[model samples]
Target: MQEYSIAYAILAFIVLVLKNDIKDKFFFSLTFILITLAGLFSYEWKDNFTAWDIFSALGGSSTIALALLALLGYLDYIRQEEEVSIWLHVKDDKGNIIQKEDTNFSILRKNCTRQELQGILGVIADVPRYELASIKESEFMKDIDAIQIGKKKKIAIIVSQEKEAYQFNSIFNNKYKKIEKLKTQTSLRIDKDSLHDAKKILNEVGMNFSEEVNIFTKMIVTHKGLSFEVKIHNDEVNDLTDKLQNALKEVARQSKEENL
Candidate 1:
């Protein structure tokens, strides 16, 4: 309290530099000061001048550092937040993705008009000779309007031209409760019919499922952003799973022979 010159300057500089968090972090600090005059007036504790003098000596540098520290902290506080992750890893030799692959997420069952699902999948190939063809065709209700609802869904599935999507369509079309797909792969959505059936089956055939399965078989619908998934299994529900599997095996066998 002997001199307020240096104290005032340091305070001013900090106020300017840390104009942002000043109001919040002020009384937020711990500080104790002994006035030389007050101590001298009191006969009890007049010997603490040494500590005050030491702090006063380093006062300018400390205040500058504190202000700089606050500014840096503020920078980090408001720094652009990173995106929530939506990624999956496949470790097979041919499946290691070196970089993000170009993906086209289709809303096959969700926003899909029968016309759209019909467009590419070729009129839901009947479950006849397809090995795992769905026998529960009567169960799949046609909720053609499920996609346009105000609240959107989060779903995940590996997309390839090969089979799974087609298999489900072939097996469960017009039978299972519904098929809902995300509008953009960016917009995660799940197949409700499959999800329901899978959940029921999960409880019934507990030990039959993969112990290592990571995605949801039954998802609790919530929207804190990240949840994308699909159910994977072969059952009576799969219409063309048998045929598709056999055909795929044949293709693999032929390619191996050609290489020889």
Candidate 2:
């Protein structure tokens, strides 16, 4: 009975980990084998134990194990919420900051669903199938709510237990139709043309975009304006905004030098 209790407790813990997207099936099966071997050595089979007796053995420890798992999951969620952050900024044509807002990742993740994200992404870029699980995980894509491009356009990236997704919009086309987003790159100078250069510059400044990993990024350039959104990870709101502002300034300076 004691061995059964220990085995059930370990099984319960393994199930909890599996629930959190971590796989450890081998450990799960191994625990059962060890428990059965212990039972054989203990001469428990000689006691004529019925199959129904296993439930009684599992009852107490299994209950405790599940309770412990729930508590641990709750604590982990609280820690993640404390760490998640996003800083939204609006910049003018010359890289001057016009406005800003600070928000948390949890708030944004719950605000939208995956289907809506795909619709919005379709409007923003030519890419098809913009789902979260399909996206590769990377440093740049961690704990971000959204990124605003220029004064008018924006992209929001969100991840949830159910799905991961991204969406895009602009001041002029806040409710933009699917067809309207089909506007050609000729209408926009930067469109998809400058994404590579922008990523290269951002990488030079320590904001590396992992090509193999899914890092949500968008770039738009036109005769009217240019904007791109990149995910940032930092708990300190003010510090994140300061770093972003400095990076933008550096990018502008570089552009000016190239022109000169």
Candidate 3:
């Protein structure tokens, strides 16, 4: 039993290492299944009257463990393949679906801070005006907004300003007769100062605005495909901007690790 336990542990470790190192799913699956079956059949079964001996007669404990691990690994591999398929299924400018291997689109990690999101948004927004597909506030959530940078990338930003939430909702819902009505209702206004500060943040991250930045009070933006959601808390804009640079650096590191 101790020998069998040691064998099972060694097999499991080998499988784990192979799963991480091997990128070709078909090859890995074939190799793993062959190895697992070989291990199972290599064991000799001897029948004894005792109950413990009966288990060994069917298949040694190590054989059963190896079989279970193979099954689990196969299931997990299928799940991973499905996820990759969904993310990689993207369309070209002509509305034709591009092959997964052909497309350069890489999915961003779902979990991102507001600052990190804003930084990404700022970088995308700094592109040529013709490159921007659309930018609009979310209809359902007041604090949530989306910007489509080019055809491939769409990002949603959700801020934690409760005061601005109601205003955005009113504007989006058509409750206000005129967008100018918002001027008197909210203390927070998009002024030159705010615009300048926003630009400064973008410049710090090596992104320069190619076109005039338009701050919209009321506009509808709808994105059908997958989008990365960014939730923002009530933090000072400058502080958020400063942290954004570091956050972006960390995100780059993580993305590189994942690709490896």
Candidate 4:
């Protein structure tokens, strides 16, 4: 029994290390065969070996297999919890909570037209390595607009001007049809009063105007197969562009890492 336990432990280790290389069907078939063989070898062949003896041996083997599976599950759960603690709630030395959280920026000036906002965002979206896909009005909301960009790594630009403020958003994804493992979102809000000066700075930087009302920008990123949400806020159009580019780069990096 000791030898059998040692052998099972070794087998479990191999499974854990090469789980990606082993197919599910092959692993299950191998497990069934090994368990059956273990049961047969352990059974004592007395003068009249009966079906009950075989059943007892198989049941004992099954109990050990189930225990091993439970142990693996517990280990995986512990690993996940540790990762969440490390990655999900990161903070700076000042305890400022530097990790992913919704951020807000204040914009104080006169209101601008939606078209003008869209043009400014269009220039911001013009980052290196990413091509503009589409610039069109949103189908759902009249006041809201969108600009689609990128090919292999796609980003959906969401701009809204429903109330008196303006908003700029960028949603990053790997696929055109469906969003896969990695996604990152960034949103910027300009209050009603700030639009005039916001437009001026953005225009001096080369202004055009357009916007969303999401109070916080939600950026979702996957690290080591674990997904978490991050929020960021910035005051300038250049900062907004930098954030978008950074997000696109992050999504690209994660996709490459995961081979998605």
Highest lDDT: give the candidate number.
4
State the weakest 10-residue window (summed lDDT) of model 2.
Answer: 180-189
RMSD values for the candidates in order, in angstroms, are 23.4, 20.5, 23.1, 25.4
Each model's lDDT comes to 0.34, 0.40, 0.39, 0.41
Question: Which regions of candidate 2 are displaced past 4 Å?
Answer: 1-46, 50-52, 76-83, 88-260
lDDT pick, better of 2 and 4:
4
What shift in Å separates residue 21 of candidate 3 from its native position after superposition? 3.0
List the candidates' TM-scores in order: 0.21, 0.25, 0.23, 0.29
Please rank every candidate by TM-score, starting with the best. Answer: 4, 2, 3, 1
List candidate 3 stretches off by more than 4 Å. 1-7, 26-31, 34-38, 45-123, 129-260
**On residues 1-260, what C-alpha lDDT tens digit does candidate 2 reach at each position?**
66556555655665555433432254434444544444434334436777766655445445444555456557545543442233333334354554444432322333333344444445544245434432244422332222111111223333321112112234223222222211111111222444566566656655543322222223232322433333443234445345545655666666668789
Ranking by lDDT: 4, 2, 3, 1
Shift in Å, residue 250, candidate 3 = 66
Model number with the top TM-score: 4
Model 4: how far is 128 from its true place, Å? 14
Give one digit per residue, the lDDT tens place, for model 4 in 1-260. Answer: 75366547555665666543555466555655565566557556688878897788777777666665566557544433331100012223354433332112111111223444344444433233222212353431232211110011112232221210012122112111111333243344445545554555544543244422223445555443466766654333456575444544554555457675
| Alpha carbon RMSD to native, model 3 | 23.1
